[model samples]
Target: MELRRRYHAKAQPGQRLPDDVWTTDALGVLSSGSKRDRVNAELFRAIAAYRQVVAKFKMGDMAGNALHRIGVIYTEYLKDPDKGFQAYQELLAHYPGTKEAVNALYKVGAYYLEKKQFAQAVKSYRQFVYNYPNDKRVQDGMLAVARCHMETKAYDKALDAYQSYLSKHPDGKHAAFAKAQVAWIRTYHY
Candidate 1:
């Protein structure tokens, strides 16, 4: 409620526009307007509710779920990717043992990857691989690291990562692609 008001109806001069007109969804983060106000009002109330659950809760999974929803509400619905990303970070940091934490790891990596921040993406993916060694996505994360390297033309590093993946899982899901990348690097980038 407070955060929503600050960002929406009660927005300051800097936050609001010259005309101060906007259209939005429920959270008021989408745009700005009367209908926007109605929608944002509802959305803001939801965030307030989620926050309450998170603040006064002991159920790890429930708390984790609330945090995850907060992240989604901010990122996906409110159009605040940074805050949403922060929420995901908080979820992982506070609830490392939760399933939401696992998903947050991937979401964090994918967010960076989508921004073409290959190095950061690699770092995030590496965290996913290291933290959840036996996760089903470990191989995918490994391949993603290699692909990020390749995307940045770090052929040598890419080849190394690819080879590492192939060595770890000879017939894993990405084995064929890893082998192909390794061979391609050797053929051209060598």
Candidate 2:
């Protein structure tokens, strides 16, 4: 790719480029051309370059950003949820304190939910709620747990999850939806 050529063109024997430099090069490649094939090729190139940055600077802020970007590229552009989940898992493992880890944690649950893996989804969502109780996503994470139970026709478990959500976040954004689901479950399902 032209982008890779440009980066290597500027490479010296013993020089360390700033993190922004690599990211900027990646962004240039991503927005360089309009051709789908070209863009796809550049995306792969960008992923590789960013991955190198992560490997070289394990604890840098850019590493976390690059990791999150890799996950997004895998999930959204390549349409490989498994690879995306793996990238997210790696981000969580390596940078558990980063903001990207919080996002990755929730996305793991979403991936499981998309696959109809309710038990795994519940586990991921519960982990998210437990680790990030004060996070803005905690309410949605709790609601997702109940939703997973309801989808699997586990009325009692769903009720319990919804009740737990309400007790913890009585004024949560999803309070009304949780209440409605609870009432419906009690009336018709249970």
Candidate 3:
């Protein structure tokens, strides 16, 4: 309750957020207490301020960036995966065209992957590739889908994904990894 009060008090609507707060991991260079508290205070202000920017000023990109930051803040800094995941999802829905969407997709997939939700991870990874075909990370997304299938011990799916990855990205960055994984899967699973 106190934290909620603090957040509301600091996060005044339409307040102008400072630029430095974004890069400030430690407001007082204090890791646990001041970092979290100060970062939350300033970031709450930023979130409020940017929300107004999106609503009134009609700045989609800026607001999308802000949403991405909020997701990161909740996920990494605040240790709240649920809120962080929600924030990321919000960004993807509201700002699908923004560059932040690409990274948000990756984070969302990562959240599911870290949770060992292999099916969800596969879906997210495939979505990442399907949605952002032009992105440099597209290969990473494709490889991730295979990795998710591999982790689930779906050797046939993994084999197909790895082969597809190798076909699509022969001599690409992860080619060796794909080849190695395919070899291992074939030798052991077959």
Candidate 4:
């Protein structure tokens, strides 16, 4: 109740919250409160803060961050995967080529994977790889491609993806795991 009051007070119409207060308030509840209380606080406060920023600036780096945080809160704390997906999609649609968009794309792919929508997961990950080939996530995205194939029981495609990943990123972080997967597939499927 008090938190709601404070949030409303700080986020009154036509009155933007101070940057410091927004940041502090968003973080404060997480630090000292119970886990459930902290998540509830984060969800409400982050939304208010984000709305205030967008209302004031229209769009900016901080607004992008706030949008990403809302997606995370929906997914991580609220356990609302659909809302999380919506928030992430909104970020990508609005922010387009920003770093936050890249992250949102990856997260969208992950959500698809979690939902067992392998085709959509592959598409999203491929989009990320195509758009940000130089980004560190490319390796992870490639690994996810192979994982999606494996999960969908496309052993041949999974093998192909693993081989491609091995060829391209021999020293990549997932190399050991990829190698193990290859050996497992050969032993079990062949």
Candidate that would win on TM-score: 2
Task: Report how far off residue 22 is in candidate 1 (Å).
Answer: 22
The reply for model 2, stretches above 4 Å from the true place, is 1-34
State the lDDT of candidate 1 residue by residue for 1-190, as single tens digits.
Answer: 4555555796544454443343343435444446555665677778888889898885557889998898888878888878788889989888989988988888899788888999999999999999999888899899889989989999989988998998899999878878887888999977
Q: What lDDT score goes with residue 126 in model 4? A: 88
Order the candidates by TM-score, highest first. 2, 3, 4, 1
**lDDT tens string, model 4, 13-128?**
45555667645655676455677876687577777777677567646777667678888888888889898898799888878867888889999999999999999999999899
What TM-score fits each model?
Answer: 0.71, 0.78, 0.74, 0.73
lDDT of each: 0.82, 0.88, 0.81, 0.84
Best by lDDT: 2
Which pairs of residues collide in model 2?
Answer: none
TM-score of model 1 relative to the true fold? 0.71
Per-prediction RMSD in angstroms? 9.7, 7.4, 8.7, 7.7
> What value of lDDT does candidate 3 attain over all alpha carbons?
0.81
lDDT of 4 at 136: 86
Clashing pairs in 3: none
The 10 consecutive residues of candidate 1 with the worst lDDT sum are 18-27
Summarize candidate 3's per-residue lDDT along 39-155 as a digit string, tens digits.
Answer: 676666766766676676445477788778878877877788888898789888888888998999989999998899989988888989888888898888888889889788899
Give residue 43's error in model 4 in angstroms.
2.6
